[model samples]
Structure formats: C-alpha cells, structure tokens
Target: MSNEAYAQQCNVRELMREDANSEVFFQKYTLSEETAARLESIREMLKDDIAQANPLWKVIAGENEEEVYSESETSNNDDESNHNESQMMHDQLVVPSTQFYFTQTERTFVETSDTSAALPQRCDILESACESLERNNGRLDFVQLENLSNEDLIPVVDEMAGKLSLKGIYNLCASMNNMTIEQKIKYLNVLCTHLLLPKIIELEEPSRLLSSAIVECVKNFPDEIQQFIFVPLLNAELKDTMLITTIINSFDLEKKAILLEEFLAYVKELKSWHISILQNFLSVRLDHNMTDKITKLFSGKALYYSKDKTFGKLILSFLKLNTALSQEQKNLMVEVVAVNETLFKRPMENILKNM
Candidate 1:
C-alpha cells in the first residue's frame, strides 16, 4: 500500500476503536441520553478545570511536554504518555458515573424562639405566644390563650406545630393542663390541621403526654373532630399502633363501632399493619351485630385470610362472641375455623355441636 493510503487506513481503524470504547463506557455506566446531555453541560461549565488537567492543553499552552512526565514513565514513554493523556481527556469529557440519589434536608432542631425576630409581622399572635411561652419556661397560660380568638389562635398553633421541636410540643402539652376542654380542643384541631401527628408520635418520651392531650381534646369534640383530627390522622400514611389505639380508645363504644366498620369497608386500601390492628379490635370488641356485619363482609372472601390462621382464628372468635348467628354465618364460621382449628384447641365437631 502507498504510505498515504496506509496512514488513512490506520486513522480509520483508530477512530473505529475509539467509538467502540466510548459506546462500551456509556453502556457500563448506564448513562441515559438526557443525563449525558446534563453531563455535557456540566463539562462545559467546568471547561477551565478540564483544560488545566489536560496534557494536550498544556502542550497547546507552550508547557514543556517532558515537564508533565512522571517518574513512572516507561521505555515506550511517548506511546504510553499519549494513551494515558487521551484516557484522562476522555474521562474529563464524561460525567462522574457515581449514582446520585436525592437527599432530604437534614432535620436539625432549630431554635424558633431565637429566630423569633425574623418571623413575619403578620404572625403577631404566633410571635406573642412564642415569646410568652418562652418567658414562662414553655408553660402556656390558659387565660392568655383563651383571650386570642380562633383567628389569632390558629396562626399561633400553626406556627408552633410547624416549627417547634418535640421538646417544644412536650412543653406545650404540659401547659395544656390548665386549658379548658374547649381551648384544648381548638389547639389540637390546629395541630391536626397542620398534620403534626408524625412529629408528635416521633417524640419518644413525651408521646404519651401528647397522645393524652389529643385523646382528651378528641373526646370533648367528637362531633367536629373528624374533619380537624381523625381524618388527618387516618390519612397521614403512618403505621403507628400507639397513635391509632389512642385515637380509637378515645371514642365511645358506638363511635368505635362505626370507626371499625368504616375501617373494614376500606380494608383492602389499608396497610397490613393497619389491618392487623382492625383484626385485634374485632377479636375483642366484636358484638353480635358487628360479628354479623363482618361475617357478611368476608363471606365470599374467606380464602383471602385462609393462609393466615391467626386471622382465621380472629374471625372465628367473633362467632364465640355471638350466640345468635344465622345458619349462614354459622356455616361461614365453621369454614373459617376449620382452616385453623389449632388456634381453638377444641375439636371443630364439639364447637359445632355447641353452636
């Protein structure tokens, strides 16, 4: 081959090899097209850093090539150096391949009292409440809270619920001892409106105090509590058994029955832990009517809980609670109970004979 033709052939082969390596690098890194574009933009932004680290740039800028050589330079130093420089330049052109996951802002206990000066002037009630509470060592004066109208109290409660730490909530609950039932209900409504249950439940030491205050408030205002509290608590995506039990136990028997019925209607939408709670309630609290309702609800879906003997036992236990079960319900109970007779220990024949 002619010298020039041979050179052209070599150049084409080198280009093909470089393209193949680039494709493999992209596949290995799983770089999407959009991500690759973003990386190109970042590379453009850091062009100065790339140029400084680039050996070709050093040569172009009139730096001595030998000055860039390391002590590890081989006997084939020219070829090795060229290859190493090319690889470094290629790496500089691509984005770092480390998987980037989005992170939430670290939760630090911010001192709202210290930052009170930065609060908006419009939040006067909030500002006053914080200052007054802080001055009294976090004890809220009932008279002071009572004097504020719903309009004023709401903003203050919202500010505290949103910004205060668990310690602050504990302090607030301590002061609530002197609050009237009406005032306590109002304050709790504000907290619930702002969806603060997760934060309240997170308070390991003061959770009982917080839960007690909430339960008391809920008891006083059960008629109006759903919109402000129970609805928010139920929809908070939390699996906190303590919180759920506290709320449920606060309700009267009639309300508790209604709540359980509502929960059963939407059982399929609930998390497993939530369903377990309902099962627990049913095991102990189910009455004749409630048992009948549940029997009808699960009549066709017996197989759903068939694999879980504990659940089957819970269902069968409902039968023991009700002696007036219809023949249909009795039959359904037998089917469910037979699936897990080990839980009952007694023979199925004897249990059926008593029925």
Candidate 2:
C-alpha cells in the first residue's frame, strides 16, 4: 500500500483503539490536540464532499433524485484509488448531510401511500423522532426525517406535542417563543390547561429548572399554581408567597376578585410578619406595578368580605380603634388615603366611639 493508504489504515486502527480506550482518553486529554485535529479534518472533508459535483451531491443540491441517482448508476470506475476515493466521498457526503432537513415537498412524497413499504415502520420512526426532537427542540433536524413522508409526518407534530406529559408539553411550548410566529402557532396547543398549580405546588424542582418551568408555566398555564410557585424564595418562605403578593399587588381590581381564593389561601399560610410584609408593600406611594396589585388586593378584599371571609373586617376593626393618632402614624395613614380616599370614608365615630 502507498503511504497515503498506510496512513488511512493507521487512522482507522488508531480510531478503533481510541474507541476502545475512549473513556480513559477523554478523562485524561479528551480535548487535546490530536483528537481535535482529526475531528476538524473530518469535518472539512465532509464539507468538501457535500460541495462535490457527484450525482448524490447534485441530488442534495436540490435536483431530482431520480435524475441524480440515474447518473450515479452509470459512472465508470477505473482503479482501487478511484473506488476508495468515491467511497470516501460518498461516506462523507451521506453522513453530514443527514443533518440537513428534508424539504417539505420531499417529506410529503415519502409519507404518501405510494411508499407503503416504508409507511408503517417509517411512520413510527418519524413519530419517535418527532417526540425526541420536541424533547430537545434545538438539536432536532430535517434530515432525520429521511425515512418518513413529510405530509403525513408534519400532521403528527401536533399529536406528538399533545401526547407529551405536561413537563414535555411545557418544554415544547417554551421552545416555540424562540421560533418565528408561524412556527410558534404551529407547535403551540391552543387548548392548554396549565393545570400547573397541582403539579408545581407539590414537587420541588431545582432552582434553574424551577425558573424555566415557571417561565413556561406563566406563558402557557395561568392556573392557581402560577401564583403559588412564582414567589421569590426569601429566606425560607415558599417563593410562591412573594409571587402572590407581587401578583395581588399588580392585578387590576377585576382579576384580583377572580383570584381571591388563591390570595386568601396565600395569606392563610403566611406568618403575621409575612402578612406584614404584604401589608407594608401596600402602604406606600409606589410605582404602577405595586400600585395595581394593592389596588386590586384592597378592592377585592372589600368585595370578598361582603361575600366571603377576607381582610375587610380587619380593616373595619382597625378603623374602629380609639388610639390617638400619632404624628408618624397619621402621616402613614395620610399616605394610604392619598392613594384611595375610600380608605378614610367611614365615620371616625363608628371607629373611635365604639373603641
């Protein structure tokens, strides 16, 4: 064999040996010079093969496969060197191009009834592939759909996304935001239940994972647990408490009423100090976000007290107190009144005379 052939044999043997000792090699110097150089050379060769003018190369260039493959069938072979070179080029071309996605037209053709031999097994493979891709959205590719028909396969995306568990569905939906608008609507489930309150309330995920889940939950699931899990973990409080206060403090008077059960449940579990934390959040000249949440909370509380148990009676009870208003205390009450005069609307006699 020529020196180049010897080198090819050596490379193959070396690669085999490397595979045998791969774990140890990786542990010691996995990212070292030799491995990287070989990998880069392989990549460059694959690129060249993809850019070659051979018939398979032409098929990949958007030509008709029948026309391309018909030409490949008649190619004249001359020598071992030529044969090996062709094999090398073919291998390089096929392997990397697998990363390119099949065109929509091509996919449609494969999935058609004309391809029945492939339809059953191919359909399964396509579904498994889609399910796999939906799980790791960023890493999926079109070429992976090589065996399946595109027309049939595309329809299955909805089913694939739907069939996934809530966690999987969350990931699929979350992945949509990064895609274009059409892509987003395509992957998104229009009837998402967001039943996250039960799921997240009970399970404690890690911080990074929890944040991602929270983000996706907010985008898709608007259920009660969104409030419960959105809280920032202050000291040891269920971060949901902080999130609840934030949400309550930001809602319109309307949404706060609808969400009263969640808010009351939030406060019920909170310590007096945390409730104080929420109360303190209210008695201030604040920005719009804080203002909205408090306005809604107080208004909703007023409504809630009329229909159910809430902080409204506590407000009336405080209103009925007889303690002489200290200057500092009066100033604070003044601040509260500045936001909503409804705060001091009750007669002082109804409060002080009874006290």
For every candidate, C-alpha RMSD to the true structure in Å: 26.5, 31.9
For model 2, residues 175-238, the per-residue Cα lDDT tens digits are 5445554533432232122223333333443334434545544544343233334332222334
Position 330, candidate 1: lDDT: 84
Q: Cα lDDT for residue 52, model 1?
A: 51
Task: Tell me each candidate's TM-score.
Answer: 0.46, 0.26
Best by lDDT: 1
Q: Write one digit per residue (lDDT tens) for candidate 1, span 1-355.
A: 8999999999999987897789674675676799999877765644455545555554444556786444225435877889999999888666443212111122222445446545444465566656655543576555555556666666666666666655566566556545677766566556556535546434444367557756765655665555555554554465455656777777777787777766655444434345445654653466566666666655545556556655555555555566677787788767655555344535443666697
Task: Quote the lDDT for 298 in model 1.
Answer: 53
Which runs of model 1 end up more than 4 angstroms from their true locations? 1-137, 140-159, 173-188, 195-206, 218-227, 231-236, 251-255, 258-271, 279-289, 296-310, 338-353
TM-score leader:
1
* CA lDDT of every candidate: 0.59, 0.46
TM-score of 1: 0.46
Q: Candidate 2: TM-score?
A: 0.26
